[model samples]
Target: MSGISRRKFLTCTLVGAGATALSLKTTDAFASAKLEGYPDSMGVLVDLGRCVGCRSCEAACNREQHLPAPAQSFDDPSVFDQTFHNGQKRRTDEQAYTVVNRYEPTATDQPVYRKSQCNHCNEPACLTSCFVNAYTKTSEGAVIYNPNICVGCRNCMIACPFNMPAYSYSSATNPVIKKCIFCYDTRLKNGLPPACVEICPQQVMTFGHRKELIEIAHERIKARPDRYIDHLYGENEVGGTSWMYLAPAPFEEVGFDTTMNNEPIISNVKDFLGTVPMVLAIWPALFTGFHLLATRKHDIEQHGDDHSAHKEEEKKS
Candidate 1:
């Protein structure tokens, strides 16, 4: 088989084994299963009203993450015009954990800038859909990945509604999915704001508890109705995201996915989850009934033979 196919097969096998391991019931069972994420986990609120698109956040991310130098400096405005094969703007990649893109709004006189990165969903699709226990949603609201255990199956990428999680395709042996981890290791652990947020000159991004950020975002919107969009981007989308947005124009005009459903990502997979219990509960009975029915003729024939023998024995008597 080709190398890619071979890797895919191995990934599938590993995923299957991991899933089986996870499915095994724990011996130390508890009465209640706690939900993921800490109650006081912090998040960031990006008010597009304040962002000047200076790319300081991008520069800080590059330095803090030790990513490769960009082809063009962060100060260069040409990056705003850069487009990929599909005419879509370039997003965060392995070299860049965060990126800012410019959007021109018809309703507004000036262009609005938006930053893109991991949204860190409350019910993260990446966490639920992962067959391997390679990803974790921390109490601090950061979705972290262990590259050592990752099989490079890229299911996390497929499952992510935000299209986050870029893979390191260039590496042959040690390739893995790469994305923003909310500066969990260096900054967030120390109770410091993320590198991007700290470096933001415009103070566009405010880091704090997600709950408080929601109220803060709304307060800003309410206070300056003319300066902000009426709705917060992550308030309901995908069961609410750790990273939220406040935009001036309708989110769609500035490249936000307005069509994203308010329901948690897991809700979309409930149909499959619902079928699983039914299959587990009904399979044995359904198969046993079929087996008994299939053997009924043979059982009846044996009974008839026994009856005939009894009649012969009676006749002899």
Candidate 2:
């Protein structure tokens, strides 16, 4: 066996360890519980047909999250016209975890309103993209953030398919990605409906287990086929979302992104994750065997040299 150099050995070990850690993170990120969903996962079902664009949900969310006041009050309808980056209307920001957007669907004189926030996906893209593992998917179906451990990479904001996360650019002291937390801290843990759901006077949002909510949505559609579209948005879009929607018009016409596939956003990175187990299983054995071989070779060389010196001394004696 050939002796290994210190640099080479360190390199091999470091490479193997790095690969193992990366693979494990990716695997854990993608490996959600069986993909059906967590047991008794809570969710919200939005019935767009029932929403009167009251903006009450927005007000409730703002108060519940205790976010900074917005430039336009939640009572202001002109907020609908406020444009931000990319000529897009205002999205969930530091001040608001949830916002409702207005759309005038074709063939309907009355405007259609849609709510926007973190979908709290079953396999959240933000969770997977976070190398620090700062994002977590709770059993109650909330996608939560931990700002302390966050490296401020802004990767989660980019990874999110919905573009839901917003950063506090003005905060020079400390900045973190912010999004809806499903009211996990204040309400979900205590088995209460979110502030937005509890406050909707029009009963536009229904809060319940994800499975039950899906059934209820379908039942509602079955009962009033004429009032709603045949499809259930968010039921299986991107491997399901805690918050879903029922629209009277086609989903795209009501400000929904219909282009997303049924597959989870994590599917984009699972390929790399599949290699994690392979590294974990192979790297240790490979490196350890190599280290032993090199060590044994060195021991044999030293022993041979010692034995030769002993023989010379004996002959001289």
Candidate 3:
């Protein structure tokens, strides 16, 4: 075949084979699949445009979650100036389930405040990557973790694209990943907004079903397009997060990582997972065939030599 024709033939064969395999695998997955978690679980959406950096939500979360008192009180504006090891500002930690970061927009006279917390992804990387099955995604759209089952491997921390989960590293004996649980055991189970959302003086945090929140966010943007950034940060990041954002300034200026692609975090790891089954199914047959081919000539020659020696021995006798 001509070079171009041969290339086309190879490309067609590979594409056809890949499509066939993918179809079969998807069919099998669907056949065995069952939905997970509580379907009616609730979530909170914080509009950055409305937050005034009052830190009321932070204080309420601290009190409700029974976290230790901050070195500076929630009312302390000094917390905004505090810097961590990398000159990065303090983020949510083991003691703080959520935090507000200030971003000064050059286009605006006043600084905008943005809250950072567990984004509660639709297909949480923490849930999928936890080897011990310590994480669960509830139907109400909360991604929660069971510390009792956690092995302290910190896979979830590494897997999280939002950098949400913080480890209790100070406690050597009982270290566990910690973050917001959407008030699952308390308010969420009872169908109430989380402490942070309930206590926001500015009505900055709106708690509801994730799907509804997306609509609400868009409506707010449409009604006041000039007042808010046109985009929702978490709408498609990591395959759509349960908690979404509507900000006045660009998300990057507000300390949000804008580099993340719209693809789910798990999608980045799919290539590795896809290789597992290919290696498992192909290795045995490939190695066995190689071993047979390698040993066949030696076995045939030994048998022929033995027959010749036997015949010579019989003639001498």
Candidate 4:
């Protein structure tokens, strides 16, 4: 449950006596440090096959976060019909932290609804890309935002591959980037499930330790292989995320970016930033040493020329 990949082949009963736990861990090119979040880092596993598109979670989120009253009521089912010009459905914005988008992979099959929100990546782009360092990955695995230091830069919005963060464009003076915070302030800090998780009537999502949830995700896949697509959405995405998913159809069908690299978004940023200190400390001395050697060579040549002239005068005497 600590995100540590075991090398030894150990037989473990997960679902039943017949089923076996597969020792499959995603390998990244960076071979970098594993951010298992905290030892007891909490996360949420969303079963997209079970979601009924009730928006109960959204209502619960609004109430828990004390957001402004929405234009549409919680009971409104018309929100499902919402669509954009490019055929993409609604996404998470300042008005809504979580949104249920309808997806129809095939013409004959029933519509599959997917919820979008902050995945809270273990190595978050928002946290690393922030010019003001506004975002934080908590020990509990909740990637929370601090508005006080936000500075309204919105670098997190640009850095987030999930496209989860939104800026409050309406606010002129004190605008800030807004998005799902995993209910860190009210419920999670108190060792309770998030309001959205608790309010989900269909039991579509479960909150627990991030690593434990990964096992549970695999167990669910093993238990019902036919129902699931066999691919876990957030398992290795951006170096794994706290909020993971199990879907009936491919993630690409549900409007997810499948071509993203396994490396954490900040891995490149770290590589670039990691060089700053090295360059600052090493380059000056290295270049200065080269300059000193060049000057010494010029001085030696000048001395040799002077010595040759003195010998010529001696020969003339």
lDDT of each: 0.84, 0.87, 0.81, 0.81
TM values, all candidates: 0.81, 0.79, 0.80, 0.82
TM-score of 3: 0.80
| Candidate 1, run of 10 with poorest lDDT | 25-34
User: Best by TM-score, which number?
Assistant: 4
| Alpha carbon lDDT at 173, candidate 3 | 96
Where does model 3 exceed 4 Å of error? 1-41, 289-317
Ranking according to TM-score, highest score first:
4, 1, 3, 2
- lDDT for residue 96 in candidate 3, whole number 0-100: 95
Model 3: lDDT to the true structure:
0.81
Off by over 4 Å in 2: 1-33, 280-317
Best by lDDT: 2
Question: What are the C-alpha RMSDs, in order, of all predicted structures?
Answer: 11.8, 6.0, 6.4, 14.4
Q: State the lDDT of candidate 3 residue by residue for 84-119, as single tens digits.
A: 888887787899999988878776778988888898
Per-residue lDDT over 54-101 for candidate 1, one digit per residue giving the tens place of the 0 to 100 score: 999999999998998998999999999999989999887778888899
lDDT of residue 109 for candidate 3 = 79
TM-score for predicted model 1 compared with the true structure: 0.81
